[model samples]
Target chain A: MRLKATNIEHFYGHEKILHGIDLEIEPSKITAIIGESGSGKTTLLAILSSLLKPTNGDVYYDDISENSIKDINAFRRKNIGFVFQFHYLIEYLTLKENIALGAFDEHNINTLMENLGIGHLANRYSNEVSGGERQRAAIARALVNKPSFVFADEPTGNLDTKNAVGVFELFKSFNDTTFVVATHDKKIIDYADVIIEMEDGVVKCISKKRV
Target chain B: MITPLKALRKNWFKTLLIFISMTVSISAIFLISAISSGVVGMYSTMLKTDGDIIVTQKGIADTFFSDINRSLEPKIINLAGVKELNSMIFGASPVDNLPIVAIYGVSANRLDNYKLISGIYPKNDEVLVGEKIYKMLNSPKKIKISKQEFKVSGVFKSKIGFEDGGVVMGLNDASKIFHKNASMMLISLEDIEAKDMVEKINNLSDDIEAKTTDNFIDNYNQFKIIKTSSDIISALAFLMGILGIISMMSMVVNDRKVEFGVMRSVGLSSTAIISRLIAEAIIISLFAYIAAIALSYIVLEVIQNIQKFQGYINGEITPQLAILVFVISIIMAIFGSLLPAIWASRIDPMSLILGGSK
Candidate 1:
């Protein structure tokens, strides 16, 4: 396991969202987390992405300490990437600038855009583009920082079947890094190397398949 | 640093409003400065164009009412550092219908300083009248002076306190007509130092005091303090204007909360965001200030040159006023932009990325 969580507990105000959760994430592999609504799938993803703090226990990033909120935030910034259902592109900037924004280096933006098949949409404003194009742009933006792990929460939740398959296949063909995605769609299940089913914030079953 | 040009392009209307506020603040300051300069300019012209020194009776607060003792005239002339001096008899009094006209008695040499617009300077026993005084004379062509009628010298003007409407005559003629002692003396310096001249005059005469022409003219009109007070009041008004602009800028930043979050996520530091906003404000304000100064100067100059104001208002716009307005505008821009920029820098990129409201 490259990233590990041990006895992690999380809460929002007085209500408990995660209880002594323990999980291991492998390197250079695609991991899928499946759960029903309100099953803590998104919450766990947020905590794993360092966007939320655990109430107790600890999370480690490849042996680096992420036990504190500051450490977790720094780790998220330098080593982790995130994508969501909304795309959330900056409306004022063009697609290319938005994608390059994550890298903090304008020089590498064009190359990343070309590689992601978004070179033609580089100058298009976020609001002017279609949902599929914006999602692709978001993926490009996430990958631009060259993070070791990419976390997605319902990335294709709002997309049609064709775009969803295309997005899953894009992640499936990524050879350079690992991915942890949460979803309910059965269409994407075939591409996962490992699938964990979550119910009521607990992992009820796990399955593995050969690709 | 986030380039301000990009921010201004993104938020054009907000930038424009900031620029407008800056313009108003700076213009208000410049207006006050111009009025002050005009007052000072009027006093300077009076001193330079009228007399070098003014002598009035000691213990008398009003120059127009001071009366000299004739027995001290020769002693004054023999004093060290003594210069050319002429006694003047001028005052105001009630007549049958209204206040009597202002009057002055001058020697031949002092007559050259008066610019007669329509008539000549007073002859040996005749009197010349101020334009305003001439109007009050009520006669069509000539007016009576003591016992003889003198044709009104062309209606004239002087940088001195000619606004009070006065008449002038030879000192001897005025003393004979008014039937009183001389009121004051106007002095012209040749090579005598002002301090030594005043000291000698003070020693020679018992009830006489000498003052620099600048001070004399300043005391003549009552508007000097008003000019300075207006400047202070306008400066305070500009400060309030800057504060108002700052609040408006805060609203602009508040409206762009999500955008700031995106910027932070994209590797923009807080410093960069603040710098960008300040730069945008400065650019907009500088442009507006320069344009406003140019417009005001042209308008003021044209107004000063109009027929009715040719002698009364000397256009006093100077480069110093423009420079002052420009600098104030820049300062106001930075002050207005600072807080919002700081807030923009504080936005968390993570909250924005994770489906949280900025």
Candidate 2:
């Protein structure tokens, strides 16, 4: 699935957070949005993922505009997943239960848990595990729905270098799902197939890595 | 995924607070209902008699204050369907250490109603004391009413609540003490003639009214006042209980805003989240209702043992009342959680994530 955003602009009250922006997210690739603080990278990612509606433009999934979709929540449920910087796993639920929150189908859950290397910790609460383990569970939750695209905002912002690399490696292994990650970390450039840098609410450069 | 259950388990203290508030509210309603039912039961038992019709002064709030001419008894007994007639006086006075003791003045023929448990029937100025009053007065040999001394002839028992805690004497002595001709008259009519007999008796005088036993009980002003008061108090208690549940649910939703945001971002719709919240509230209310039933029973038992409420209140919980309370509990649950659930559904996932990031 291809995600396209054209002439996108956003405002928080009277302050404009994002200017007119246009981008196309190619299918099945790691597209990283890298920028310093307050550059509106997170805002743009939110717009493309259907978490927030842009003030001036619309996002499209394979030529179907968001405005045309009758139920946006249903569309996101069937096609999109999310990972936040804080790994917002419900504290009361077990890791397995947290992952099941996003699953529309249950047959693949066990297999996915085992592949994530946290199968033995499935019954442990999110607070009972380490930060890296919790984030891994969050990633498992994102992919459990078998969505076409996974939007992550600073998913590894709280992890160490080793854990951050491991997270990117996990993202790289899922070749069928497009990943759009917004972060300021330079390490993501090594694994990203496409990198878009933003400064002060506008795109500074778009660079594609040669195969 | 049992998220609501898991959340309740994790926050056991909050769950307990909500449970207790709901239980108290339900119990208040149940207790009021039980007491009202008990009072009605006592009245029903007291009014039960072999007589088919009762005659009393019209427009009186209490039968104790009713005053009918004693000469009407002879005319009523001579009526076509009249089999027998008994005149009686009812009054209340403080005796010994007791306040407001019921006093019944009965004719000699009405002695059949009292089951003599200890001694013989009363005569002239003598009196028969009820079992409860006997115990309360420590088997007194004689008592004083209106500065007149009367010997205690015996101790008797009756199913009637007022009779069980009262003093019974000869009708003439009661008339002298109360300074009245008669309070009321009881008429025993031939089979299937009560309706015609009541009308004939009512026509005998303009100041007196005659009614069959059932009609008399139905129109009793005291019973109506008790029932209406109980209903009003129960309604207020139910409202307060619902408000308590709403406040508790609002707190729960406020504390879980971020969790709801996470759920929404993961593709759970707003309706699904609201359903979960309502489900939780219902579960809590159901458990509270069960607890309230048990609590009401315990309270009733304790009250039944008190000397003042002995025969007057049986403290029975009827099936109809229980079912009514159960239905009210479910309604309370839904209404209490609706506002909070709607508030939770309107939360913006993006704002939560962004706010948390900062």
Candidate 3:
């Protein structure tokens, strides 16, 4: 599915965070949104993923605008998944249970955990596992539902360079699903098919890499 | 997929606080209900007589204070369906150091209701002491009432609550001591249907009123007051319990806001989250109710064993009371969780995740 945002604008009280942003996320590709602090990377990622309703303009999945959908939650539940900077796994639940939160078929959870290379840690709590392993579990949870689009906001922000590269490799391996990662890490440019760089609250440049 | 048990287990301290609050509140309700029921039960047993109808002073609030002229007994006995009439005087007097001791003065025929435990029936200056009173008085051979000394002829026990903690003597002696003619008269009927006889007896004298045993018990004002007061107190305690649950659930929801946001971000609907919270509240209430029942039962047993309450208070946790507690618990769960559930359903996931990010 194609995700498109048209002239998106956002405000936090009196201050404008995003200004007239236009972008199209191609299907089955990794689109990296890179910017410095206070550049509205997280806000734009939130707006594009339907997590936040834009102050002005709209986001569309294929030909259907977000405004046209009667139940935005139902829409998100059926098609969207999110991975935050902090893994955001429930402290009481095990990794497998956390992953199962997004799973339509619980039976597929074990195989997905195994594919994420954290199957052995499936029964470990989020606090019990290492940071890299926890982030892997978060990724597994996001993809467990087989959503068409996975929006990750600085998913590797807390990980070391080796673990961050490993996370990008995991996104690369999942070729059938589209991933939109908003981050400060320049390392993601190596793995992304499309890189959209931002300055202040506006897009500075867009670069496409040859496969 | 959202099970409440995991959250409860993880937050055991909060769960324990809520559990203790609910248990204490529910136990208060159950204990008050049991004691009230016991009071009514004791009165019912004491009021039981072999006669079909009872005659007492008209418009009296308590039968203990009823004063009917002894001359009316002849008229009551002559009424149709009247096979026998027994006059009795009831009063309360301090004996020795005891604060209040129930005194029943009846004719020898009324002695049939008591089972002799260690002594014969009393006459004139002699009195039969109740088993409990005898023990409380240290099995004394004599007890003084109203500046008059009487020999303790024997000890007796009875199913009637008043008879087990009271003194029984001849009606003439009681009249002399209490300075009253007679408190009430019990009339036995040849036929069980005594409704007409009651009316006839009532019309015979202006000071006396007649009532079937069932009618007399149903209209007893003391029992009604006791029951109403108990119910009001129990309701207040139950309300406190509900408030405790609401406060606890609201705190839990506030503490888990970020968790709820994560859940929403992962595709769980707001309704699903609220349902999970309600389920948790209900589960906590159920456990607390069970604990309260056990606690109330223990407290009741301790009370029943106390010397002052022995034979007079037989507190039991009836099935109806248990079921009532269960129903109240469910109500507490639902009402308690309503506001918190609404608050939980309205949580915006985007802001929480973004807030955590920045």
TM-score of chain A of each: 0.93, 0.98, 0.97
**Candidate with better lDDT, 1 vs 2:** 2
Across residues B143-251, which tens digit of lDDT does each residue of candidate 3 receive? 9999999999999986655678889999999999888889988888896578888878878888888898778888888888989999999999989988998898889
Query: Per-residue lDDT tens digits of candidate 2, residues B115-156?
Result: 999889999989998888888888899988777888999999
lDDT of 1 by residue, B195-250 (tens): 67777777776678877776666675445565658678777857866786788788
Instruction: List runs of model 1 lying over 4 Å from the truth.
Output: A1-84, A100-103, A145-153, A172-174, A177-211, B1-3, B6-10, B48-79, B82-111, B115-118, B122-152, B155-224, B298-315, B350-358
Tell me the alpha-carbon RMSD of every candidate. 6.1, 2.6, 2.7
Stronger candidate by DockQ (2 vs 3): 2
Question: Interface Cα RMSD for all candidates?
Answer: 3.4, 1.1, 1.4
Q: Score the docking of each candidate (DockQ).
A: 0.27, 0.71, 0.64
Q: Per-residue error at B219 for model 3, in Å?
A: 3.2
Stretches > 4 Å off in candidate 3: B49-52, B83-86, B159-162, B186-198, B308-313, B355-358
**Candidate rank order under TM-score:** 2, 3, 1
The TM-score that candidate 3 achieves is: 0.91
Best by DockQ: 2
Give model 2's TM-score versus the native structure: 0.92
Clashing pairs in 2: none
